[model samples]
Target: MNEPIISVSGLRGVVGGSLAPDVAMRYVAAFSAVAPAGAIVVARDSRPSGRMLASAVHATLCALGRPALDAGVAPTPTVGVLVRRLGAAGGIQISASHNPPEYNGLKLFGPQGRLLTAAEGEQVLAQYRHSGPAWVPYDRLGGWQEIEDPLGPHLDAVLSVVDAGLIRSRHFHVVLDANHGAGGALGRRLLEALGCRVTLLGEAADGQFEHPPEPTAENLAGVGAAVASAAADVGFCLDPDADRLAVIDEAGRYVGEEYTLALCVAHVLADRRGPVVTNCSSSRMTADLAQRFGVPLVRSAVGEANVVSAMVQCGAVFGGEGNGGPIDPRVGLVRDSFVGMAHILAAMARRGLPVSRLVEELPRYEIVKTKMTLQRHRVPAALDALEAHFSGARADRLDGLRLDWPDRWLLVRPSNTEPIVRAVAEAKTRHQAQELCDQAAQVIAALG
Candidate 1:
């Protein structure tokens, strides 16, 4: 079997090839060993392999004499919130996120309802490698129970963060494309709670997606067309786990994920002025918003846990990533598609502007992303060349190498899941963004 891709967040791989039943069992047991002594919340996405993997996790938790609270087929953020609501030791979400259907993985969350910090995750990883599962005797075996209302707390949490009554007054016509992931029900409930007239695409949470589940521009052309045909005020698209979101205008234009954070930051800063945090790989729009609002915008290493740690340390009012993850601390530390939807709709309601107009108000930048297969050993050389080539610009080595200017920026980071270096650039125009990415790719290729 191929070695599974392991990280501080969690592990993922092709089901039968790398992530088999035994592998899942061992990993869950490893997590169980280090987790606090309390019930563990377990949830899965809509993928078929989710059930198989979840069963292993449940059995392992039970065998270790830890009670397992199963939240069946829910979004990843829901599990995060549920962990804190239930006062459990930690939580595990069975999902591969936006990866292809054949892939599935697990994401671990701490008791505070956030992804585990790097230090905590390293302890789990070390325990998994050095120790074995301590299965309990028959008399000490634990039990299992299914959660009756997993979505209720999550919905209430999101509603509390936004003015639901104001959103309801507008009665906005909205389209939601969940792509048959675990978010269908929650997405519908959130819109209905806000009194929006919602039209759902792929309402069934059967893991059978109508299109690719990433919510990218090219992959969601059909959804954009549907939004235009329905004449909806806005469209929201979610990934398989519903942690990421992308926006579509009434005219069927894809607003992409980067704008999701910018719009939410705008709405958040309108009412509260405090620090904001985003990953190093996120777009510069948030930085622009922070400056416009006269607030500090702190950039962290590229991960949800890192962002959450920074937010907690800085007491940030809003934080998220460029990949459509808007993390409102009032809601939960995890990236939440529901939070994104509420904030975007609330922004529209408050401004009385169309989705297109709301997007137009924000600073716009063209972002281009590309990746190249490069061995780990060559990464340092590539970074050296990139730094020397762009010596005129300010450099940031937080996660990888990020070079920045007043109007443009370039990021080169090695993938946590794949053996490739990803290069991303944003500028005033598409041509400039593409040129930056191409130039970085050339430098990496020359290292060969």
Candidate 2:
């Protein structure tokens, strides 16, 4: 039997291979066993498999006599917002994030409308592994309800964070590439509300992806070219789940995902002076921005849940990961593409400059990411060896072995979603970053 990749947050795998209808039902049953008592909200991206999985989730919830609030075909962040707005006990989003079309998965949210923390997720996983479905009697079965106007509340929340009137007056010509995900619906609404002349791509929520699902530099080349060809002031690209965003300048430059967080931090710090947070894997641009405002910047382990956990602990004003995900506690805890888009437009309007110019104002660095396979048991020894090898640099063992220099840093950590150890390095020069990764990889290889 094929086993699905399960984590504290949720599970993802190829549909028939590991994520079958039974698997979905069983996971939802496990979730129902532990979720807070009340209604549970359900949402999904544009994946073709979403409907099937949604049905399984709904059935499982009904069997457990838990009300299922269905928010049909919405972004992942929308589920988070609805969980809070409707006072639901929990929420489940059916999305594989930026994975290829063949992949689909579930992301669990707690009552606070945020992804489950490591502890909370572990509880659910434990229940999932041990408990069988407790089917309620026929008369006690739960009912289903549809969420009408699902995007309105989320739209209002996003618009409130930016200078809507100022952005409206600028009438910036913008390009949005939703890539046939749930984002296009709200992306169009948000952009139009900000008074931009919008050129939308893949506006339908049919799950037919036009390009690679991930919004990386290589995947966004066509999007950048489209931005240049459209003669727009800027372009925004969203993953299939619309939780992440990538930027494309008017000159067809792919700004990548790191700038999404830095640019938003810059805008937020301009008005509010408070603590900021990001995962360790994020670029240092946000750190520089926080320093410019004389506010503290904190780094958590690499994951949205980890970042949100630290943000809550530190009372952060804004926080997010580097992969085009920005979390504003004001809107919601989930990583929101809409929040990133609105803040970016607000930054552009506030600076009265092109997207590229705004990006140039931030401290610049080159980051290289590489990964290698290693048995789990050997990870600690490898980290110890690395720490000794780079003994001269500042060492941190928060999530992994992180060695930092005055102008560069390297993080070698195991992946939460895969079996490989990911090595990420950032420096003033690309060569330096690549060299660090190469050295680390060699060390791990020799240890193996």
Give RMSD to native, each candidate: 1.2, 0.9
lDDT of 1 at 105: 94
How many collisions per candidate? 0, 0
- The window of 10 residues in a row where model 2 has the poorest summed lDDT is 413-422
- lDDT per residue, candidate 2, 1-448, as tens digits? 6888898899999999988999888888888888889999999999999999999899889989999999999999999999999999999999999999889999999999999999999988888888888999999999999999989889999998888999998999989999999999999999999999999999999999999999998888888889998899999999999999999988989998999999999999999999999988899899989999999999998889999999999999999999999999989999999999999999999889998999999999999999999877788999999999999999999998889898999999987666789999999999999999999999988974
lDDT of each: 0.94, 0.93
Tens digits of per-residue lDDT for model 1, 296-388: 999999999999999999999999999999999998999999999999999999999998998999998998989989887788888989999
lDDT of 1: 0.94
In candidate 1, which residue ranges exceed 4 Å CA deviation? none
TM-score against truth, every candidate: 0.98, 0.99
Please name the candidate that would achieve the greatest TM-score relative to the true structure.
2
